[model samples]
Target: MSRKLLPDFLARAHDDRDPSPWLALWLDQSTPLPDPVKTAWLADSSSASRQYLLPFLRPLARTVIVLLQVVKVFFPRNWSHSGALHALLVWGLKRFVSPQANWLILRHFHLGSQVLAFIARNSPAPVPTSPLEPTDIDALRDDLFLKHDLNLFNFVIRLNQALRDQGLELHKPAHLDLTMLRDPDLKLEDMPHGRLNFLDLQSAIELFTPLYQLLLTDNDFWRAANSLQLDETIGIYCATLLAAPEHLVLVNNKHPLVPLSTLRAGHRLVIHGLSTEMLHALLMRFKQAQAEGGVVHTTSGDASAQ
Candidate 1:
């Protein structure tokens, strides 16, 4: 159930960006080799019938090595060297193996960990001594979403601060509509798709200004960017929402303020349409929260507080 909450955009993005051959080769070379025992055993033997015996044993050895690597994926540690050997063998096999197969394995392992991490971090806190009523759940859900948005807002503020520290500035364009950047019908020729070197200020601005705008203005796009920039944060947010004991349906309920539907819709719109001025205001709020060693709490009845 938690896994289902994992965003589809993440999976699509992962599939779309297949690593270049050069990157694959470099990654293979860069991975550390297994310890000496396995290397020595595979390197050669000095028995009388070694030539005939090794040919038969090599396949079994490779299989065992691969299995060990699969185990290491779950239990990462320095105890065994078989996993290292497995990596080397897999890397070697990439040259002869189908690219699709290699990509599938790499993509699954990498993306699986990301999902697991998201689940771990964002799983809901245990219910209090008194189990939460629907209203309590509603408040908690809204609070979590607010926290997630503010966290992203703070991150951008920090990024800007870092840039300033390095004598760089992030210019917020006067007219920015991120929705256009994400139009599915937009032609590839019109897209800013190319190699970018952030070290060059012009290149950085050309690439990131539009990207930052998109992050600010598009909820789906912002969530995807958050997933990439801060892995599983969005997943955790979704998971936390899904983990709510019961979905609030506030059609004719006696809530003091807005309906749950309105609250939800408005929250989404506010996050998606976040402007530079709003972000700066959020940054200030976050700083104050940090200085006070507490969070800025938003009441369930007052959506404006968020």
Candidate 2:
């Protein structure tokens, strides 16, 4: 039975602009890759590939900066980070990167850190107590950027579906065709490992800003913060889907993800939203869920004892 879980599951308080709840729910609920071995293999392979490939890619990543430098010479002496170049880059991303892939990549950083923060909060062993500032979160982002390819993650999602079609159960062995990823309709949130919330633009910007500073021509970090409208659309769709009252009437129908936003008067910039206090809240919930036989694991295959 599809019972209504939390009425405010997707609703934020009128005064709250905090993006953690949606991001955490998405991380906690993203479909777990079917096998732990696959997870380890992904990490192992991605690490090796990055070590081999980054030397080549680093120069390509630098091409953006070179283009910007040339444009600066030909254009105004006062070309700013928030100027036409930034807009064109954002437009190109929207224009070229598959919408699904774009959403997946940007949200992955926020969700990835949420996964780490969840672990840091729940670890039986003591770890560092310092809050993750923007710089620290940037380090985490850079580490992750070097570790995994998004296409590999996308391929695993397809492989999981193929395994399911063959009646394979979770954690069981299976072999599948790699070509399934070529399907036109695959989406990141379609599988049933758990529920995912939605994407928020600001969350992506928080993690992306540092990389923008390091790789792109925007040496002035403060002025380069930005986001896409696609983030807002996906977020609204997911939030509204879960929050809809129609679920009461159509009890057996698959509920769509839903959306909403609450505007407030105060302004604050969240570098990386994960913090010590947020970790504390996540820890308490993790304990309660563990008591209830629900253990959180990452999509990269950090499984808990069942």
Candidate 3:
């Protein structure tokens, strides 16, 4: 498949009202695509976008759709790629710098309608019949619920909207279990080797509690930058995990290593995508912490003593 023919194939799929032929040609890129409509086969990948060159969606899309159909019976939310990543990608690709490529990418992913809806106009907020009156039932419920747990400014704003959407005259929805942690085990927010700042201590405890394991993505040891917020910093490291190895590693962004031992299944260890030497240094620190009874957890699993 050549870039020259991908658009043509898509147009052909639309005309034929079936993706099987398009899919066949799609799969054949490195091989040969099968065309049920015209009873033809094509050889070669249609494009060079690395992702397009791969046969990911070509073979898996139909299977994924079938799985989604079954999962839909049990899950209230949509988990289809179209609903999750596809919808998100639709928004992102629509904003892609190249106008033609944006449209093409959406079409390539079969996200045309969502792209159109996004481009059309702003979504409207529902009009409220009344404000938060002091005597109102909703006002009373608001006092009972959503009056705590969240920062006041944002909390009030979200609570008001949720109350309105429920169509209930009462003020609040019941408190949800979302605020609680599912696991009871002790967790470590890894302090980078350098000296710790007081706020970093606070922020680490805040951010790392929920996520027990981290796979470091780069050569750079994560120093808690006084200037940088922990959330943004942690997010950057986590995003790099896709390129990391199957086993948890502490690596500089460019290289990877296999830790000498396996981690216990439940230990909330942060993984760094790091090299062997760096991994050893970090693991040793864990050992010191363990010997000193600094960390509350232990593993008979394979992770090495640093």
Task: Give the best candidate by TM-score.
Answer: 2
The C-alpha lDDT values of all candidates are 0.28, 0.30, 0.24
The TM-scores of all predictions, comma-separated, are: 0.19, 0.25, 0.17
Model 2: runs farther than 4 Å from truth?
A: 1-79, 83-86, 109-113, 116-291, 294-306
lDDT of 2 by residue, 186-223 (tens): 23333121222221223223223334444433323222
Candidate 2 TM-score to native: 0.25
Query: What is the clash tally of candidate 3?
Result: 37
How many collisions per candidate?
0, 10, 37
Instruction: Estimate the Cα RMSD of every predicted model relative to the unseen true structure.
Output: 25.3, 20.3, 26.5
Scored by lDDT, model 3 comes in at 0.24
Query: Model 1 — TM-score against the truth?
Result: 0.19
Winning model by lDDT: 2
